[model samples]
Target: MATKKRKKISQAFTKSQLVKEISERCDLNKNQVTHVLDEMKDIIASHLKKNGPEKFTLPGILKIQVRNVDAKPSREGINPFTKEPTVYPAKAASRKVRVTPLKQLKEMA
Candidate 1:
């Protein structure tokens, strides 16, 4: 039996590249594209802060939700490098954002 090798995929889009691409597609200036992106970020942040861990969806694109995580209890652990025993302190609860692609986006992929 022979195994097939999987292909490696490597590509990334930076903020500047995103602005340029959006500007070109929408026939808008780079500044305008950047402004729109900035506004979107602000709007999402404000909504999350106000609502406290709710879902926000962009139709046919993606869904984003903020989640509140509970605190972790303290525990004893060892330092890998020094091989020394240590007491790990408890961690306070934190918030995290989760993203999920919508059906349309998933189909495209």
Candidate 2:
């Protein structure tokens, strides 16, 4: 089967443009599309909560996860240019959001 080639986008679509296009394609009103998008945002946020599931998957599109990063201790190091001793500041442990594209999303690119 032949597949249609997609036009390369020079810039990202704005929220309003995205909503407009989705509404037209889905046969829904702009407000309805906006509501649906907002709900999706809320659902993803809830899923990545501290006590809730740290991972969320939109099948065939992407997976989002919250990962814990280990803290780094301060250390002494030599300055490359000056050849002098210096102390590197310690970094506090933090959580980060990681997004991985799925197979279908990768294929679309």
Candidate 3:
């Protein structure tokens, strides 16, 4: 028996493509769609900056969170190439964004 190959799915969208699709669906101009998307980006950035490390939910779509990662302490290690002992310095704490899909959106998928 012969098996059929499955079609690959596209998992990414560019700003122009998103703007075009949303404009068509909403019956709005591309400029308006772009503005809305830009504004949404600005709002999310502002919230993340102001709130620091916390989850910010976007209703039924998804939740975004800022995470603060602690640095690793300095440690001694052997260099593989030179076979010499070296001390690795500690890393500074940093923040990052995390995203989680809402149940409603996950269910639709």
| Each prediction's TM-score versus the true structure | 0.67, 0.86, 0.72
Q: Candidates ranked by TM-score, best first?
A: 2, 3, 1
- In model 1, the clashing pairs are none
Q: By TM-score, is 1 or 3 better?
A: 3
lDDT of 2 by residue, 43-93 (tens): 999999998899999999999999999999999999999999999999999
Pitting candidate 1 against candidate 2, the one with the higher lDDT is: 2
lDDT of 3 by residue, 6-94 (tens): 34548776878778767776778999998998999888887788454366689999999988898889999999999999998999889
Best by TM-score: 2
Compose the digit string of candidate 1's lDDT tens values, residues 38-86.
Answer: 9998877776784544777888999988888999999999999899999
Spell out the clash pairs found in candidate 2. Answer: none
| Candidate closest to the true structure, highest lDDT | 2
Q: How does residue 69 of candidate 3 score in lDDT? A: 92
lDDT of 2 at 37: 98
- Which RMSD values do the candidates have, in order? 9.5, 3.5, 8.0
The number of clashing residue pairs in model 1 is: 0
